[model samples]
Target: MQLTVAPIPFFWSKDTWSAFYEEIAETSVDRVVLGELVCSKRLPFFQDQIPGAIERLIAAGKDVALTSLALITLKRERKLTADLVEMGLEVEINDLSVLSYLPKGTNFSVGPLVNVYNEGTLRWLASLGATRICLPPELPLASVEILAKEAEALGVTIEVWGHGRLPLAISGRCYHARLHGRTKDNCQFACEDDPDGLDVATLDGQPFLTMNGVQTLSDSYATTVHQIDQLRAAGVTALRLSPQSQGFADLCHQYRALVEGQCSSEAVLNAITGQTPEIRFSDGFLTGDRGVAMSTPPIAART
Candidate 1:
């Protein structure tokens, strides 16, 4: 399997976002989906930089796609969605409303935030000219296997959410803004302080989730080190890796090595933990268990 970098979910400065994509252009990732996916307000800070980033990525032989806002509600937002088609790049629809805006017969993609829980939904999306789809992180392995088969028969490629904090939900209410005693309009970009998202915890202070403006995410980074073989065996074509605050380029190569059999699971786990020792890792969503659960083969764990 190969890698497709998901759009940046957290709020970051223009320089940081630009530099991150510049570095990504040189990585082994096969494709990238980039844009303001969470909040439209955050777009102006870095929207101008997108063309340059996309140009560089394409110049380096990477397939690039623009993403629709995960929650498009307002009139201006609708205009933005409608305008995405005019950019002349593949558009990955996170919200179903985008389907209305895409020109007929345009071959687009679908992001994980959209629900594709069954073969019927997958088939419907395939009928709508969707060429690629990154399945939601919460899908079980059985579902993935079934969907992969359906995608192959329908001439569509299926990608899995291979790594990164699980994006649990997106809301019209900004949790960051509410936490700081403000409304969505008055959020003042509170999410900017947490580049990787602010950690949310239980009353006893156990890490539970993360809040990135309107998006709720898992505190643990989800990795597929132990499940890659099974996924490949099931005919999965690609793995989507979400962008993090740091060590992502190195993380990309490590995943590539793991897929190519050049590195052991132990080496990958070690490399990942060594880079960001504090972040938790999980793989349970694919295992038919609670989303946060983690397990490994004895050989993989001991290696």
Candidate 2:
């Protein structure tokens, strides 16, 4: 199975972002999807570094792709989408609106943010020159199996969200700014303070969600420690691991070990938990009631 590193969903400094990719280039990951996929306002901070990052990842023998912004509204954002084709890399379409602007006959991949829930959608994207797709993180294994089969028949490659915070929703409002009593336009870059996203909790103080500028993600990292085999059995060609601020390159190594059968699922899960014992891990979206579900053991889930 191929291991892919997803673009950084949180806002990090250019130095940090550059260093992260520099480290990843030395890892065992097969592909790296870099560039902005969240707020376009954050683009200018690190956009100039992208070209060099792409060149480095490519030189390291990795297939690299550029990701489109999840929600595009501004005219400038529209132009940005229209220009991804010229990047000369696979443009991973995160928003459906990008489809209208994609250069004619350009081979593209679908990001998990776009709703690719069923065979109809899968086949439709395939028909439109989608050579690869990362299934939405919320999909169950049954849906994954069906889509994987469709991808196989259509000669498209299938990928799944393997690890990192689950991106729940994107809104026009900037929650991080609103939390500090500001609006989206004049928020003063509040999100940059929280590189991994500001953690939100329930009334009773339970860690619940993470608030990026406009995107909401799960507080617990969404992991698929046990689902690797199932996904491979279902024809998933790669696993997209979203980038985090710290301990990320190590994560790439751990995942590569798991993918290559060098470690057990429980061992990998235990090791991950050992690294950050406080945060919870979930594969419920692929195995149980909801995204937070984590009752069944790895062996049990296999059955």
Locate the minimum summed-lDDT window of 10 residues in model 1: 294-303
Residue 165 error, candidate 2, Å = 0.5
lDDT of 1 at 6: 96
Off by over 4 Å in 2: 300-303
Q: Please give, for residues 113-223, the per-residue lDDT of candidate 2 as tens digits.
A: 999999999999998899999999999999999999999999999999999999999999999989999999998999999988999999999999999999999998988
TM-score on alpha carbons, each prediction: 0.98, 0.97
TM-score of structure candidate 1: 0.98
Candidate 1 lDDT over residue span 188-213, tens digit each? 99999999999999999999999999
Looking at model 1, residue 77 earns an lDDT score of: 97
Query: Best-fitting candidate, measured by lDDT?
Result: 1
Q: What is candidate 1's local distance difference test score?
A: 0.92
lDDT of 2: 0.90
Name the top TM-score candidate.
Answer: 1
lDDT per model vs. reference: 0.92, 0.90
